[model samples]
Target chain A: MLEARNLSVRYGSLTILDNVSFAVGDKQWVMIVGPNGAGKSTVVNAVSRGAPYTGQILLDGKDIRKYKSTELARKIGVLAQDTPVGYSFSVEEVVGLGRYAYSGGMLSSKSSGDAEFVERALELTGLKELRRQSILTLSGGEKQRTFLAQVLAQDPELLILDEPTNHLDLVFQKQTFALIKNWIEETGRSVISVVHDLSLAKAYGTHALLMHRGRLVASGEIPDVLTRENLTSVYDMDVHDWMRKMLSQWEDGQSGNLPV
Target chain B: MKKREGFSLVTYLLFTLAVLVTLIFCVCAGSVSVPVKETVSLIWRAILGAELPQSTAKAIILNVRLPRVICVGFVGASLSICGAAMQGLLRNPLADGTTLGVSSGASIGAILAIAFGVSIPGIEGGGTVVMAIVFAFLALMIILSLAYKLDYTLSTNTIILIGVIFTMFAGSIISLLVTFAGDHVKSIMFWTMGSLSGSSYGNAVTIAAAFAVCAAVLLSCARELNAFAISEDNARNIGVNVRRVKLIVLIAVSALIGVSVSIGGTIGFVGLVIPHMTRMITGPNHKKLLPASIFAGAVFLMLADLVSRVILSPLELPIGVVTSFIGSITFVYIFYSSRKGRG
Candidate 1:
């Protein structure tokens, strides 16, 4: 289980996240949905210990601050929004880097177990064919999957993804979310994702946290929290009728794409 | 795939043969052409323990040509390896040993040693070696400490900036010392121009030892260096203590550069051009790149020294000048080709 207590983050004098509190229990799929500049990334960064915050974050009932960087990496895998490209490492080599925290040091040899895990990760992410290909040659969607493979290789207790579907096509987006869902079901691991697609969040997430201007407007079970009233209030859009229509379609295993 | 690999191997073999032929041609073409027969016989006698008459041929081959050849090889290898390592560490293709101020720092120490008339204890002709190591290590420490104090991230630009500042300081000191040592100006000038004429057996041994140690240390850290080439943050995340690795590499490379410069004077371009050339043939994987740089550097310098001697006959120009000229031309060619390829 992971929990953030009274989390607040400020950049200079500007408060980015104001006293937000949330928690995710084991095997839960929690989705954070907000409009642009809604501090969703900040909350994810704060939980991953990438950004400083005023409140405490606890993982498995222990303060995350007590853990070292590698220790934290071992427990929680974070895939940031922007994956910078510079290195010339092969796809396999980059994926293998996910086991870095467990590798001890540069000169230390990888264990047989670690290698197996890496192979499995490549297999799961469907990167086996592109293992030896240079990462620079990969397409955008393939690159995202490569990073996803790396996160899978980490095998963290909690996976934190910030816009994992960005830069992905519809097929890739569906494949990626389905893969995440399957992973959670198989491993019984928890996940907290910052998403922009309301339909995706409503489709796969078990819990939802809605935010606006860095303030948590609503949080509960997905069906309870994702109401037409809540969506219209936070987004300042006339999405009440559209959401009700989508909700009914969603109940019938259909995703009604609302016009923006 | 097998055919492709075989073709690459064959190409490498042809390249090696060509370099060997060039090396022999270089050795045989110097002023006062010792006949090819005499040169071969002299080398055979030395190797086979045959008693040859004490001729100038023996002296020329053993003392002058051999030392110069060995010095050229050692200095070239040292500079290229340092260049490759620095480029990888800083993740900048343009970072070379000189850009890091190592050559200038060593030059300052060499000049100071000459100016102060300091001699090594017990070991004759060890002054340059000791001074080179000392000044190189000192300058490296200063740069590293300054970077650390400023909480500056290790980047190519930051390192280059520090190197530029140190180069200015070292050059000023060198100028001041040269101004004061009017009588020794010729010696200082010779040292500055960088010649292989005064290389001795002791200097050769010292330089060879330094190169071997540095190469071994760097080879063992090849994987770490590759990891660093990606990104420091990534390197750290991958279980490498990035700061410590950078420090160790800096100290080791500076020492090699220092010792090489002390023995052969401030030779340039070998470090910058050799590694770049090596990378062009081989990919950026440091495992293969490091060894290729070493061999290519040695071959490049040997040919450069030979040309410097044979090009002007008895009025030998500085090997350093020849190397710089050759290096600049090759660099221009590479720059042009890379730009054209990109376009």
Candidate 2:
């Protein structure tokens, strides 16, 4: 389990992430959702130690700041958005780099126990076919898959993803969440993801944290936190009516062309 | 996998042999050309403590060419490896000691020694060497910290622009020193242009020792460098202690650059061109690229130094002139070819 207490992040004169806190239990897929600039990504940054924040982030009851980087790496992996691959590294090479923590040091390379993990990641992400292909030549969707496979190879206890499917196709988005869902079910792990797609979040998450303008407006079960009233208040819109209109377009027998 | 390792081992042996052959050839073919056969035989006999016939060729090879060649080899290796390591660490293809202004910063200290006739007590080129190192560290830290503050991803143009500005700043300081040197202006100017003419066994040994230690440290961080080649944030998320690795790597690189600049002046382009060539031939895996670049760099510099000495015959051309001439041309080609549209 992981928990954050009174987490706050300030950028000199402005506060990016106001005092906000949440917890994630084992095997729970917790979705943090809100409009743009709601500090969703900031929480992920603070949790990953990418940004400095005041307050305690505990993993297994120990402060995350106290854990060795390698120790924390074995527990948490992040697949961030828009991470560029500069060189012409092959998909396999990029995926294998995920085994760096297991490599035992910054310098050493070990493949003894990593081949299987990398192979599985490749297979799961549908990247096995492109393992030898240069990452530079891959499309955005394929590149996203490459990075996702890399995080999969990391094999962390808690996977943190921030809009990880931004460049992915709809099918890949489903596959990625399903893959993480399967991993959580099998290993009893957890995932904390910040997603803007409400339907995707509602369909996959076990719990939800709703944020607004750097504040946590609501938190609880997916259904309770995403209530029409809370959504309307936070978004300043008729959230249910908008959703109904979008869903109506996909309704069966309306177009008489395909089943929804 | 076993086959691959064996294949790499053979390549390494072949590369080492090439470096050795180049070293001997450089020793043999100088202004006073010593025959290759005689050069090898004499070197072997000398190593075994056997007396050789006293000849002009033997004297030239032993007293003049050998030390300069050795110094060139180590300086070449250090500069090339430092360039490759930095490119990886900073996640920018354009990154190198010369481009990053570390070399220019280092030359300032060397110039200071020449202008003021300053020498630290009991240390050979003590003031120059120590000052070169201090200024190199200061320059590298300034560039890295400022780059970090300005851009999180270390964009190619931004970092290089910063380095360009830093190099200009250091150049102005050197110009100021030269203006006041009075009689030492020629010496300071010549040092900035770079030459291995005054090289001695002491300088070669110091550079070799520093190169060995720093190469070991950089080689140890190959994985971290590989992670860094993607992005700093990605490196951190994957468990690399970005700050720690960056500190260790930059310090080692700075020490190597300081020692090289102090001993051989500020040789340009060998660092920039050699690593780019190495990546093209050997691929981007630092595990292989780092070692390959070191060997390739040593050989390339020895050849360049030879060209510098022989191209003008009796009068010597600055090694820096030779390298920058070739390096700038090659860099333009690489840039237009590989990074044409992507950049």
Candidate 3:
């Protein structure tokens, strides 16, 4: 279990995240959704030690801050929306780098049995053919998968995704999410994702943490946390009615005429 | 683009063969320009017995050319390794001693030592080497820190601009020292121009040992260097101690550059050109790139040194001038190809 107890983050005198508390249970795919300033990414950054925060982040009842960065890396893997290509490393080479922590200390350029993980990651992400291709030459979706393959090679129990499919086109977006869903379901691993699309969150999340202006507005089962009142209150708009109206356009029962 | 995954054994063999050929060719074709057959037999005879019917050709080959060639070879390898590591670490192709200000910064100690050697007294011999290494690393840290402080990303423009500024600042200090030295100014100015002349086996062995240790440290960091290519945050996420790896790489690369500069005096373009060309062949994998740079750099500088010695016949051109001429052409080609690739 990963629990955040009264976690808060501040930059200078301005508060970014305020006393937010939540827990991710086994096999849970929790989605954090809110407006632009919701501190959703901050929550992920705080756990990753990218940002300093107050209170405690407990991974299996131990304070996360106490864990070394590499030790912590073995527990949490990140797949961000856009990963820049710095050079022309081939897909496999980039994926293999995820095995860095597993290397046999310093001065011994050896790793014990990591090829299996890399191979499996490559196969799972459907990048076996592109393994030899330079990452810089790959298309955006392909590049994202290469990074996903890298994270898969890392083999963390808890996957953290920040707008993982936000920039992808329709087919790639579905492909990416389906892959994530399969990885979570097949491996029984959990995920903490910060997503902008409510429909995606509603379709895939097992639990939901709703936030607004840096505070936890609500949290619990997806259906409960995403109720019309909770969403409307936090968003300051009629989110449910608006979503259904948008959904009506694609529904099977929709009339083939303008709404006039 | 279709690229081979790892550098094949064929490439390594070709490079090794090329180094051997170049070494012999360089040794033979100098001011005297001996034939390949004669150069080989002379080397063979020298190895067989220390004492021979000593001739001027033998003396020039054994006492002069051989040591200088070996020293220049190691110096080339050291500079190239440093370049490759820095380029990988910074994730920028144009990053090296000149752009990063390390070459000029590290020159401070060497310039001081030459301008005021007897005054410092006790630690002239050993202290010069240490001071160069220290300044090289310090310049790197200060430049990186200032760039990062200015902009979180350490953008290319910021780094290059800071490097140029740092070079000017170091140049001013060097100028002030030159003004005060009066008589020593000529010697200090010549050394700053950079050359591989006056090399002895003593200097060659010292450079060879430093190259071995420093290259080993950098080679060990091949994986970390690969990680750093992605980005610092990503490297950390993948379990690399980014800070530690950065420190280790900087220190090792700095030492490599420092040792080369102290002995060879800031030969440019070897570091910039060799590693980049190696990367194109090795596909940016540091595991292959670093080793390949060793061969490529050794051969490149050896060739440059040959040109410096022979291009003007009896009156030698500065090795730095030869490298700069070649480096400019290579750099332009690299820039054009890279931009074209991106486009």
As for candidate 1, its clashing pairs are none
The top-ranked prediction according to lDDT is: 2
Error of 3 at A105 (Å): 2.6
**Superposed model 2: Cα runs more than 4 Å off:** A244-260, B1-7
lDDT of 1 by residue, B1-343 (tens): 1012112566568756755555555556688667777777777787799898798878888767766677777788888999899878876665675666778778888888888887888977578777877887788778757765665555545776787798788878888999998787888887666888888878889889999998988876776777677665555544455657887888789889888888888887688788887876776667767878887888888888887887877788898898878777875676576556435
Query: Residues B178-248, candidate 2, lDDT per residue (tens digit)?
Result: 88989998778876888888889889878988988999999988888888987788888889988899999
Candidate 2 lDDT tens digits, A136-155: 89988888888888988999
True contacts kept of 2: 0.73
iRMS of every model, one decimal? 4.6, 1.8, 4.4
**Model 2 lDDT, residue B72, Cα:** 93
Q: Is candidate 1 or candidate 2 better by lDDT?
A: 2
* TM-score per candidate: 0.77, 0.95, 0.93
- Comparison by DockQ, 1 against 3, better one: 3
What are the per-residue Cα lDDT tens digits for candidate 3 across A1-260? 89999999999999999999999998999999988899999999998778899999999899987877678788889887687767898898989887776764566554666888898888878888888898988888888888888999999989999887787875566666667777887889999999887877776789999999999999988999988999899888878766555543233322211110
* Candidate 3 stretches greater than 4 Å from native: A109-113, A244-260, B1-14, B45-49, B118-124, B340-343
TM-score of chain A of each: 0.91, 0.91, 0.91
User: Measured with DockQ on alpha carbons, how good is candidate 3?
Assistant: 0.51
> Candidate 2 chain A: worst 10 consecutive residues by lDDT?
A251-260
TM-score computed on alpha carbons, candidate 1: 0.77
